[model samples]
Target: MRARLMIRYILGEMIPTFFMGVIVFILILLTFQALRLTDYILIHGVKVISVVEMMGFLSTSFLPILFPMSLLFAVVLTYGRLSADAEIVAFRSIGLGMPSIIAPALILSILIGILSLQTSFHIAPWGNRQFELLVTKLGSEKPATIVKEATFSEGFFDRVVYANKVNSKTGALEHVFVYDESTPDNPVTVIAREGRIIQEKTDLGNAASLRLSDGSIHRTSQGRHTKIDFSTYDVSLLDPAEQQFRSKTPPSLTIEELKARMKTKGLKKDERLSLEI
Candidate 1:
């Protein structure tokens, strides 16, 4: 009963300190993170709420690293205070073993380590993927804002668009040029006298459409070029970043997925070894 009481006493002192340390560490990290995120928001004219949401996602991803450091700080602070108060000497005088003194910390460390492993391998990766999806959604929602006058905009998938003049308020473009490379072997280019952007809600999601007037489409394949003129044309815009987010690498896979992958065939020996490690 006395041993259990001693362990409980140690934990009672340590738990509050551990939480305080976690708060301090997270604040310090956010201070540096806010500087960069603020700069990005200002330069890109992004919404403040979006930035805040992004920060929350990033903070979630950092829990694995923060948990261990916070626990260490709590251990050091708690033991240092006890040492200063001569508690160690008093405990030794009572014939209590060093293992008994250290047992509580050891058990807590193991528990925290297990939790950290779950966070690092599963939660962190999920947060990272969510962050990428948020970026893609933000960019896709404002396709016109991403384009600039007299600049080659590569925001659209497999296409580059340029406008000699742009009216930001009206989402209108003058003297536009677009190079489309949707097909690897064949390419198309379009030149238009005027154009406008249209954002529409579709079943899949938000979609961007560019409507061009008095444009000529030029298609080239196998060293042959065909040209056609049209009174007006409309093309859909796709966000390439969405594709990248969808095809994340192994680091984004959860612990369960990794185990399943290990059982699958056609994995290289090195790949299986790396996963095992």
Candidate 2:
């Protein structure tokens, strides 16, 4: 009965401290992420609800690291307090051996280890993938967030865009200029009086549509010059970041996926190393 009571008492002390430590450590790790997410709201004009969802995904990613650190902190603090109060001495004096006193902490550590293993293998990877997908969706859905006014922006694939003024509320661009090198042999240049960004869902994925009014297309190829004037024109806007994100396997693949990838033939040294890591 005394042994059971001792075990229960030790657990009662450790469980609350463990949870508190997890909260404190997770907050510490998430501070920088929160600041970055704040930029998405303030600068990129992302919705608060989306930012909150991003934070939730990020918190799950932090759990694998935070769990072990928090467990260690809880153990050290709880035991240090008990030792300072001479509880350890009193327990030893009451015929409890060192192993008996340490058993409860050991059991708690094992439980935490099991939880941390599951988080590292499964939960964290899923969270990371979700975060990446969300960011990509945001970038594709709101192309204005990627393009800044009065600057040459090259984030769009195979194209450089410049806008003298951008209307945040309506996503309208004034005095828009685009240099398109999507065709290597013949390059095209477009200048427009007014333009707006539109998003469309296609079979492949979400695509950005840059609609221009009162624009002219200029092309030069094989020592020949061609110019065409138009009332309206549409240019496809593809962000390179989104393309790259789609092409590469996310760094946080589950352990099973990593193992399968490692078994593939003709793997590059760097890719194999990354998978192993």
Candidate 3:
């Protein structure tokens, strides 16, 4: 019967894909988790607990990306295997047209797409919020939570920033380096005899600044150059946003919620209606 074949197709496409997705998700999560160790340990005083917590948090955030990828891989691999096995030929021999063969797969794809849309809108927003809160809590407890200077570093608000050397002894940012080569911002070298944290609360976002002192400022911008002999300066860390954050769970929400987002923009009524037709 048509119904049985459709059911078979849906199961064939989705199940193996789900397992592959989990494997890919774990691998990606571990890769990022490993990198966090260098910077986290540098600041948190290397500990087993820190590693476990970091891994846990990162994996929570990787689910959304994995779902769509898994669905794609599932459809491709399943159909490929069927074709190679001459299943398509068998179907054709029984009067199965292309549409007939694709019916179940298409239905399954639509279902997965609906799930993905929900994850991105509602579930992802909450997940991202938790991620930000976790990072904030960890950052307050361990300054190294925000310290990402293991390699050529880029800040949330900055394009280029680096730490030539971070003093493990005093928790001081020494040989501290930063280059905002983006033409609009200053191009400068910041040498902090020592740097420490100073937190400030703001209406728009949570803010923290690195207090850099005993440092001179060298700045160049937009066909102008200046050198300022200064005693102190502070670099601000911008606040995290709700929409930009993603959750760790591959959760689902309804289509009504998703359609409220910009992703649904193309689906809405247009001013140029009937013009193309």
Candidate 4:
């Protein structure tokens, strides 16, 4: 009964410290992420709520790194304070062993380590995949949300957009120039007198469509330029959400799926190496 009470006393001293350590470590790690995420929101024009949601997902992903460190700090700090007060000396004078005094901390560490393993092996990858999906959903917005007037906007559907005037409400644009590099070998530059950006919702996700009026498309290939005029033309932008189902990359896959993949015939050397490591 006395040993159990002593263990409880030690645990009471350590658990609060463990939680505090976790909060401090998480805040320190998240500070750098907060700065980068803030920049992403400002540059991409993403909503604050959406950014907050992403941060929540990121916090979950960081647990595997935080847990063990927090437990260690809690154990070290609690024992150090107890030692400073001569608690260890008093316990030793009474014939209690060093291991007896430290047993509570060891048990707590073991429990925390088990939980941390679950976070590392199971939860982290799932959170990462969700984070990626959120990014994809945010990127599928209309060019009007992304483009600043009279400035070159690159990375939209792997094309560059420059518009003299923009109507954010209607997604309308004027004097628009778009350079399409989707086909690296055959590049195309389009100039439009007027254009509008449209977002279509499909079963997959949002898709960006550029509707240009009174435009001329200049295609270049093999040192030759072919120009064509059109009254109206529509072009599709890169949809990040569309790539979600193409393949289950290793990072997005669970342990079960990886084990199943290992059983597949003719697994490449790289695949075998990745699974092994």
Q: How accurate locally, in lDDT, is each candidate? A: 0.81, 0.83, 0.59, 0.82
- Tens-place lDDT per residue, model 4, 1-277, is 6567778889999999999998999788889898768866776678899998888778778888899889989999999999999987887787778788989999998899888887877897788778877765787764576777999987665579999998876889999999987666798999999999988877766787889999899998999989999999998764546667644557666778778888999887877887766
Which residue ranges in model 3 land beyond 4 Å of their true spot? 5-13, 19-29, 37-65, 76-98, 120-137, 144-153, 156-165, 173-189, 192-211, 219-222, 232-277
Residue 131, model 4, lDDT: 81
Q: Candidate 1 — which pairs collide?
A: none
lDDT of 1: 0.81
Off by over 4 Å in 2: 148-198, 201-206, 209-248
Give model 1's TM-score versus the native structure: 0.66
Best by TM-score: 2
Task: Give the CA lDDT, 0 to 100, for residue 30 in model 2.
Answer: 80
Per-residue lDDT tens digits for candidate 3, residues 218-258, read: 77778787877667887754444532353222232223533
Q: Write the per-residue lDDT of candidate 1 for residues 58-86, one digit (tens) a residue.
A: 87788888999999998999889889999
Which 10 consecutive residues of model 3 have the lowest summed lDDT? 268-277
Q: Report how far residue 217 has shifted in candidate 3, in Å.
A: 3.0
**What is the Cα-based lDDT of residue 149 in candidate 1?**
82
What does the lDDT read for residue 84 in candidate 1? 97
Instruction: Answer with 2 or 4, whichever has the higher lDDT.
Output: 2
Candidate 2 residue 13 Cα shift, in angstroms, is 0.8
Q: Estimate each model's TM-score.
A: 0.66, 0.72, 0.56, 0.68
Cα lDDT over the full model 2? 0.83
Q: Write the per-residue lDDT of candidate 2 for residues 153-179, one digit (tens) a residue.
A: 884544788999987667899999999
Candidate 1 vs 2: which has more TM-score: 2
Arrange candidates by TM-score, descending: 2, 4, 1, 3
